[model samples]
Target: MSPPVTAPAGRKKTLSHPKKANNMPRQPRTFKAFIVLCAIALSSPFTTPATQNAQAQQNRAVQNQMQNDPDTGSKKGWWSGLPREKKMLYTTTASAAAIAVWGLATWDYGSSSGFHTAHEGAFEENAKYGGADKMGHYFATYAISDMLTGLYKSYGYDTRKANNYGVLSAWAVQAFMEIGDATSESQGFSWEDTMMNTLGALTSILMARYPALDDKIDLRVEYIANVRIGGIFDDYSNQFYSIVLKLDGFDFIKNNFLKYLELSAGYYTRGYDTDEVKKRRSVFAGVSFNLSRFFYQKHYNKTGKVLEYLQLPYTVLKGSRDLD
Candidate 1:
């Protein structure tokens, strides 16, 4: 072989490095206006007279219960005297503030020259992370609603009020985040994300109104270890979005061995972080032991609660079909 090549006498040689995969920019904040819209939406869940009349009767029953319940009258904490709406406002505001700070510090919020919009294809096989980000939006709002429902109930709000406030709070918080994204240099407001957020919040309300449904189905995220990208929430390559149906939810199955099993359907993407040319989107069906139910049976309630939203790896035996 010939001698190794070299730069000309007067020129300097430059070294080239492999390019890094671009992480999707972090995602929001017209809160006051959005709150008005949320209120209008919440005020009318049904349009027909018969359904409206039924809802009115239900509301009156809830009010009667609250008026008669001794626990509702008890003063247990410093904020007990505050109105439930004010409590919800304060809590929502605090959550928004925390998210704003996080966005500013890590997501470069307000660094853009002006507000903008981005068209992130929703659940399209070719979209970024094969639409894992959309699932992220859905999961975030759904989880937030569930947590806020518990909070509102603890604050003495009745079931309907608590469910309504939870959805409202979750929607408002997500809308604020999207508004912030509009101002970020590396991110833009995404209508698809907003739509997913709404779906998530609505699902939460549906589950709250029907405990049996909640017990039967779960929307969850599963994370497997991989190279870090931005943060855990931003690590799409390692994450899977799953919709699980638990046999334990059925009365007959609950008394049999099948109760310890669960079926899951999910979507995930691969090679987005390091190999765009070979990126793949896949849909999967899986069977997994009901670890959440196991935790509940062991009386590890807190662990069970966490498992409800997060699927532990190595627990699922899955088969996947590539979308592209």
Candidate 2:
């Protein structure tokens, strides 16, 4: 059946010409349906590519804000210089303690029996199994600690200063060992050891340099475990354990047991070797003891807490328990 067609609004109702009467153009059903569909598509709220991109950008901006916010991580307070006299006193004490402990422990191993047994086997074993080939594990560890402690004192614990203290420490260690190589007739240094020490120092320095960025960066703990592993050999073991015990104070043994336990946990956890044993061994082998130094500084001095207590000046405790 044919449908009746309507004429244009301004056209006459009937066409007089034969050509116009039968063959006049008419809209197809397909074309009419397409026009209706197009109108519906245009009216929809579905976003275009540009709008989607804008929305994606907004999401990324939100994520960035959450990541960069200071609240997401801790920050150090303004610079507080360590008093010169105090710094000198602490440095002298720390150096003396370190030297005494190293000497006493190494000698206790019976390596000091006229020929230096402590240096022979331990040094050999460290050279073979340890990541670097030159210096023995103990020597390396001592050197690293000494260098880093010097860095801490040099900066006076100022967090405001750029934190390349680690790198500075590492370089110092390298330089000192190399100088030892040149100067010491009995204990000549090896280039291999020097290079390895450099590598290890770089890792510590870089980590310390970008502490904020490196906070969550986890490495295999076993790499530093060499410090504890020395315990397997009785002489070295006693020395380390005794030092830690003494640091807690002989009088306060009971009170400091928990602290000692925590130190042990740190030593073990960081030293446990898995896949990271190889990589971290080279990087962290000599520097593990520095962790102990860090602990001593933070806890022993209680610098932050001391500053806070000083700032209050006891006024806030006017009616407090201490006053009572």
Candidate 3:
């Protein structure tokens, strides 16, 4: 018989729709660079001396107004400022755009394979150290909720109520992302991931609402690098997680020099899904600066405040044990 014909090289041929596989449902490799660029761009507007003075003056004016007006001091009510109609319109438009963007990004974009689905519960088992990627989701949601909590507080919302708003906002974003994941052929929706996200967000909101826990504890993430073929956040392997407890939160150390110190406990896992190295988990106990209680006046120190929230660049000391 004559030789059977085959599709030409360097091209994909299909009569029906192409299978939406091979495109990983994860952040782009350039994500870190993208975040750095975004930070620089966002802060550039306040760089010039004139702009600085203007901003400082504006902050002072707002502070003065808040100080003077008993009703408008600090935060406004949930119903304050923008009209509800405009808020709804903006929200609807943003949600639509987000869905569209997700579709474009995930429907096997730039993938080398076709769409394929797995048997139920097939991908869920032994899903790489309990889907450590879920930690990424948790941290992301927590950070967003924390930011929104601060913003809502700055806008003068009642503290507890503002925290609720932050939680809801984080939950909404998580829902959108999770829905996208559920639809992807290359990946399945993970309940573990969702629960971790809730746990992360709850910590942020609860701290915002109670204030006492905020005074005592700090949840922080540290990363190095992770590389797995099908891993979420595969580019970074050592995403160390930590919770710091301020000694000053207790009366015994509140008046002593120890007030400036904090004790942190952290966990990290490495080498998952790799044949060259064994999967390892590490437990960490460390010390970090407890600068949250530090007071500043006469300046709107946005940069310092942000730095205080982050562990800062290169200033942590730790001891660890590998739990093989």
Candidate 4:
């Protein structure tokens, strides 16, 4: 065999052994690993020390709720009556922490604070200039609303609303930030941000109202009869089209508006990603407790329902009844 033909220097010599098949597929390239690492790095600074502390409190609440309703899956109360001072401290601290995260995320590490990011108006402007068809628009809206909802829920606000409080809150928070940004030296009011915020808030409200719809569905599944989540992704679709008409000046999806609605029905339901979800739930519980304390003390301090609410978890756990 002429002393076993030598292989090329750079390439592997696996072919030298005939028994080892070269047909085995090459190892798959994985950007997933890079994406995960980047995500961690990006999200890390956003979790402030104060936020972490609040998240701990929220975790305790969730654990208590779970113990109280191992099968019921109903949330238990924890902050029926904290003092006014405590409540204010809680809210101020949590809000400041969230704001810090937002500031840092938007901050430029290089200069103190400039009028533009390196890419300047290109990415944000194009996202706006391109109109409502872009995924960045959707992501922006979803991220803001989702983050707000998570924060509010963490603070202990019962957001299950028939009216528009949730949207109001979402819009209020985002619009305020936008106003601040517009007044700033670097970034001015991009119609894109406004349109995106409006769509996101409206989407959240609409979805909250009609929890079961199919066509615009992102994740369509039911955890139980009447109890479901992620059915009305169309609400966001509606907001998109509306913005298209208002800002982008388009109406292509207009005709199919009615047909676009969709409803989902199922037995099993998948939840959010494990780590983030858990952290979110903790944040939700902490905020909930803090807010509850403020509200209860303001309204029912004399009645002493605060203690009642705190013990409510224990009662629910002991009762082991189905969620109402």
Candidate 5:
């Protein structure tokens, strides 16, 4: 046995943060934008004529219109539904949601006063820069739209029309926030944020319109638990260090067994709130499970449905690594 065969110590290879090497000038939310662009490219050709498609799917039984039908496909009056008390309850609940979003937009945030920064081309600097914040925007927009769709569906709206109203409600809140940020003395509305939000909302819409494709993929996010709440709004480190998954892309067996498994690659940023730690942008890869997949009978329904709004756990503990 060659005992103690210790070689002379040479220069040790130090592990460094990845952001230093690939520090390209990214426009706020650049990675999400790239992801959205790729989704769009793979979705379908952009040449479909909207008017023609609309006419092709026009209501076939418009001649036998019912009195209880909604006035328009996308909106309804406060008193349009049955049971006045239920309608009022729905109205109140919906209004509360809107008000909550308003409060968030108007929050002072207590940061350096660079408010109302809607100057031309100013978004280049303020647009979250594809950091953890972009993941929040994406997750929220997708989640909210799905919730609204369910709310509208409960009120007896058609699937297409309900989805439209849901998208509208989600975008309305997002738009309000963006406008507020634009006018903020401390912050400017960021095109980067806008891009991610739009992509998220559009994802819900696309999923709603295409049930087949929605069955094949699942979009989900997870947060690492940390002590700092970082106020009621933004948590750049723990909350923002989101694990986003575009799951179940590889079902090699074509059976439902592999249908719930997924692959994930995500961005992580260190020390955004501090000046002390060297801000090293890192990337990670991992595998996660759609818990619902194990109990297929329960979640057999596809996306764009109300029940899909529940943030199901990526239950399985699996492997992950920071990319070099």
Candidate 6:
């Protein structure tokens, strides 16, 4: 299972500064580097025909073993032989408790006089971090649900049961976090965030119920490595939240060169962390190599799984339209 990318649940104020004058000139050079790197990745030994064929054979053998081996059933009870629902209940309770403790310590929860609400605008030009934070909320819940689905499946739950529990667990956990925010001195519950979280959990349920849809689309976050002082999860200026459409998901494209390509559209904000006077919100569309599929083809299954939720930086060439 892929790890969930946690989103920050609190907001912090920053001092405003002037925008950089020479920032525009660096983009072309950066894109040129990206193109070169992508070219190398495509032609690398990992994608060679021989390597792919060998990997396919290895994967098939592994799948056959899992299906036929009686030992697999015995191994299912390796974790204390607990019932499925009991495992789920314990896991969810523990996770929520852990998050609550962390929030109370770091986010100033319970420091406020009373419960409160915040009216953070959604996707508006002037909204906090130009609404990048909203997308973070969405992606966090979506990823959490997906991760929980895998966990529940391992706990011996059927597919439908696992997915439902995953969705509900994710929603509950996020709602818990938001409620904690309502009691915080530095933050308050925002309906907009809750709405996005609900949508994300719903999307996860839909995708889990439909394998073809899951294969076709992904919600991924691309993080640019920078000398930023904070954790990557909360670095809105260095993150792009993207919806990727894999061309290989279609039968017509699966056998062709186009299978290695994907289409992406995403949003990101610039100068938000530094609180520049000219904060920019941009929406972008681009073509990216389907590296996750490539890794799967090469039998790097774990890496492929991670890439499904995390977009590798410098793997795309985007043309962005500034919204602000």
What are the models' TM-scores?
A: 0.74, 0.29, 0.65, 0.32, 0.56, 0.77
lDDT per residue, candidate 1, 127-169, as tens digits? 6546766776777677667666656765657667877887788
- Model 4 per-residue lDDT tens digits across residues 1-324: 000000000001111221123242111001111122223223322222234467678768876976787863433334534543454346434534553354345421122233321111212222211222222233334333433333344444434531243345445544444443443233333454556557655665554455342012231101121213223221111111111101111234454332322222111111211112321110000001122223333654212211211111211111111111
Per-candidate clash tally = 6, 8, 10, 16, 9, 0
Off by over 4 Å in 6: 1-3, 7-78, 226-233
Model 3 lDDT tens row, 147-233: 555444444454466567756765675665445545555443446556766886787767766656765776665644345444333
Q: Candidate 3: give the clashing pairs.
A: 19-115, 20-115, 75-155, 75-156, 76-156, 225-236, 225-237, 226-234, 226-236, 226-237
Write out the backbone clash pairs for model 1. Answer: 28-177, 28-178, 28-179, 28-180, 28-181, 29-179
- Cα error, candidate 2, residue 315 (Å): 49
TM-score, candidate number 1: 0.74
Q: How many backbone clashes does candidate 6 have?
A: 0
> lDDT score, residue 218, model 1?
81
- Evaluate candidate 6 by giving its C-alpha RMSD to the native, one decimal: 9.3
User: Judged by TM-score relative to the true structure, which candidate is superior, 1 or 2?
Assistant: 1
Q: Write the per-residue lDDT of candidate 5 for residues 1-324, one digit (tens) a residue.
A: 000000000000111221213342111222232233223223311111222244334434441343356555335454653653465346435644653454345333222244433322211222222245665566556655655554455454656776777666666666655654554333455565577678878888987798656655555444344435343223344332233343444435566656666555555554543343444455656665655344334533232122122233343254444322
Instruction: Note the residue pairs that clash in candidate 5.
Output: 29-130, 114-185, 114-186, 115-184, 115-185, 115-186, 116-183, 116-184, 116-185
Ranking by lDDT: 6, 1, 3, 5, 4, 2
Per-residue alpha-carbon lDDT of candidate 2 for residues 76-127, written as tens digits (9 for 90 to 100)? 3323234534544463455345433532342121221242101212123232
Whole-model lDDT per candidate: 0.64, 0.28, 0.49, 0.29, 0.43, 0.67
Task: TM-score winner between 3 and 4, please give it.
Answer: 3
Per-residue error at 132 for model 4, in Å?
A: 8.2
Which ten-residue region of model 6 has the weakest summed lDDT? 24-33
Ranking by TM-score: 6, 1, 3, 5, 4, 2
- Can you give the lDDT of residue 162 in candidate 2? 19
